[model samples]
Target: MGDGLLVFDGRCGFCTRSVGWARALDRRGRVEMRPYQEPGVPESIGTDAATCSEAVQWQGRDGVRLEGAAAVNALLDTVSGTRIPSTVYRVTGGLQERVYRWVADHRSRFPGMTPYCESHPAECAS
Candidate 1:
C-alpha cells in the first residue's frame, strides 16, 4: 500500500466509526484519515471543503481522486480485512454508489450519530 489521504466528515458518528475500523485494518500505514473540519485538509487535496462535506474523498499519492463509494473501495483495497467489499465493488457496477448514497442520506438516523451531533448542531445536517 502507498500513501493517500482520506477526508471524511469528522462529526458524523458513522463516518468516524468507519474511519476507525479502516485505520485499524490498514496495517501498512499507508492511509491517513482526516476530518473535513481539519484545517488545510481541502487545500492539501486541491479541492474545496464542500466536496468533503458531500462525500468521503481519497487523494492518491499522485493526485488522483476517488469520491463517495469509489473512495471507500480504494481505501478498502489497501486494508487487509476488506477484500470482500473490494470484490463486491469490482463486480457490482453502480451498486456501491447507490448503497453509499442511501447510507449517507440516512446517516442522521443511525445509532450514535444523533448523540454525537448534540455538541455541534450544524453538523447534524452534514
Candidate 2:
C-alpha cells in the first residue's frame, strides 16, 4: 500500500467531517490522517497550528510532500483512483491557496474552532 499522510485540525468540526469522508472513500486504507495537535508527531511533519492552518499537507514515504489543494487532491487519488478528474477539478494550486487563506482568516465560525488561547481569541488560529 502507498503511504499517504493527512494533516488536519483535531478540534475542527469541518476537519473531522473531511476525515470521515476520507475514511469512507479510502477503501484500500492508503491514507492516514494525523491531527496536527496529536502528540508524538515529528516537528518536521509540522505538528503546529501555523503549518496545519496554512495548508493541508500530504507526506508520503521518503518525505514526498504535497501542500494545499494538492494535498487534498492527493488524498482523493489515494482513496479513489478513478476520481482523478474530480480531484483535479478541486485542487488547483492558486485556488487552493485562496481557500486556505479564507479558512485561516475566519476560522471562528467553524464548529469546534478552539480559540488559540484561553485568554485570547486570536490564539486559536490553528
Shift in Å, residue 77, candidate 2: 1.1
Q: What lDDT does the true structure give each of the candidates?
A: 0.77, 0.64
- Most TM-score-accurate candidate: 1
TM-score of each: 0.79, 0.68
Q: lDDT (0-100) at residue 74 of candidate 2?
A: 70
Number of backbone clashes in candidate 1: 0
Model 1 regions more than 4 Å off: 81-87, 113-126
Q: Candidate 2 on 8-122: residue-level lDDT in tens?
A: 6665666666677788988888877766655544355645556776666787655777776677777777677666744565656677667866875665567643321322333
C-alpha lDDT of residue 99 in model 2: 83
Q: Give lDDT tens digits, candidate 1, residues 1-126.
A: 167789888778888778778888888788988777777777788888788888999987778888999888878776654567667787984987998889988876776443333455564344
